[model samples]
Target chain A: MELFSIILLLVMGVATIGSAILALTTKKTDVAILAAGAISLFASIFFLVLASPDVAMTEAAIGAGLSTFLFFVILRKTEQNAEK
Target chain B: MLLSIENIALASGILLILIGLLGALTNKNIIRMIVAFSIFDTGVNILIVTFGYMPGRTAPIIDGAKVTAQNIAQVAIDPVPQALVLTAIVIGFGVTALMLVFALKMHEKRKSLDINDYTDLKW
Candidate 1:
């Protein structure tokens, strides 16, 4: 079990760093937003692995779910304004 | 010796903070900077939880089976950071929402997403 958890931690750490880099380097706003959301989702999983389920749930709901939705809304509004 | 999970988590959290700082500092777009800030917030939350963790422990809930009153300290992880993180998560959400609103208002006023365009107040 310890071995499995260590492997999971390594994988999550890599994914978190990779997604963060993607969020940082992406030129497109939408892609960057998606990558940021992915970072939150992975962080929530990491929280669960670290024995914090409450924090994980909050991160999943607020960070991954609501924050992404809010970003999309703003992006759409900005694009609409640009088209006008 | 191989690094423990706690050390690995701590290192990763620090790396995340650095990545977010880089993105926040370099991004030209206001919305992208906000996204980077959220990433930084997540990194802080990870660090807080990592600090609260103990090896071979369970959740901090006292269900009376796995974790009883007598063995609570021995079996359960620290609950303080989890509570603090919960508040931080909500506050982070509120702050993000406020920032997005500000971004929209700025775009409305200037018709551009570039932070460079809003240097009217600069000396």
Candidate 2:
């Protein structure tokens, strides 16, 4: 079980790093925001795998849902889609 | 090795931490940074819950039947994390609200959302 958990943890780590790299390197600000949100969503899944349902619920609700909504709201308002 | 619940929780906790770190460091927008803060908070919440779980444990409820003080004490899940998470949720909510307020204020001041545009203090 521990081994499996370790494997899952590794997978989660890879996803996190990948999304972070994308978020940082992406030229488009909107794409970066989306990647950032994806990282949060994956993190919530990681919380669920850890058997922390209460925390997982909060992560999914606030991290994934509300946070993403906030980012999208900003994106829409700013129209700052141009890459830097 | 057979999978167990403990392993599951541990995996999730680590994963959440990694993602939160990535989000915080990589995202550029101020609003996205605020969202990343919430994600990081969520990661902390996951760690708290992982601490609360005990193998072969039962709920802390007392029904006075098929549940005794010793039984509850010996196998009861830690209530500390649950309480901590509750407090964290409220605090996190407040922080998010404040972040929103700050974002709005900044936007109103600059009429811009780009973090790079705020260069008054920049060297």
Candidate 3:
């Protein structure tokens, strides 16, 4: 069980780090928002594997679900051509 | 086994903190930064739970069997982390909701989601 948890956590850690890097480097708002959501999901999984189910669920809901929705809503409301 | 478990827990906690800091520092998107902040919180919660674990312990809740003081102290898991995680969850919700509102307001004013475009306060 410990080994399984450790491996899951390491995988989650990599996914999170990758997503954060991608979120920063991506030029498109939609892509960045999606990356951010993905990172949140992975982080939530890490929380669960580390034995904090409550935090995992909250991160899944508020961080990944609602926040992503909010980002997309904002993205749709704003113009995408201002940066060029 | 005990030493390895402690090492794993420590590594996981450190990894979470590092990821959160990286997200906050490098990510310019407001939503991304919020997510990173939440990640950091989750890491700390995990650490709390990790401390609650013991080699041969039952759940924190008490039942009819073996409810003595020493048994309660020895066998029961710590309930503090569970409580702390609950509070963190509520706070995370409030912060996310506020961030959403701010994102909307910024959208209404600036007409763009790009952080670079919101340069009105820039000197």
* Ranking of models by TM-score: 1, 3, 2
* Top candidate when judged by lDDT against the true structure: 1
- Per model, how many backbone clashes are there? 0, 4, 0
What are the iRMS values of all candidates?
A: 0.8, 4.6, 3.6
**Weakest 10 consecutive residues, lDDT, candidate 3 chain B?**
B1-10
Better of 2 and 3 by DockQ: 3
Cα lDDT tens digits for candidate 1, A1-84: 878888898999999999999988877899999998998999988998899999999999999999999999999998888887
Fnat value of model 3: 0.28
Top-TM-score structure, candidate number = 1
Reported per model, the fraction of native interface contacts reproduced equals 0.83, 0.14, 0.28
* Model 3 alpha-carbon drift over 4 Å, by segment: A79-84, B1-6, B55-72, B114-123
lDDT of prediction 1: 0.92
Candidate number with the higher TM-score (1 or 2): 1
Question: In candidate 3, how many Å is residue B44 off?
Answer: 3.7
TM-score of chain A of 3: 0.89
Cα lDDT tens digits for candidate 2, A4-84: 656776676567657766765666767766775676677666655554556556766776677567766756655543332
Clashing residue pairs in candidate 1 are none
Which rank order by lDDT, best down to worst?
A: 1, 3, 2
lDDT digits (tens) for residues B1-123 of candidate 1: 366788888988999899999989998999999999999999999999999999999898889788899999889998999999999999999999999999998888889999999999999
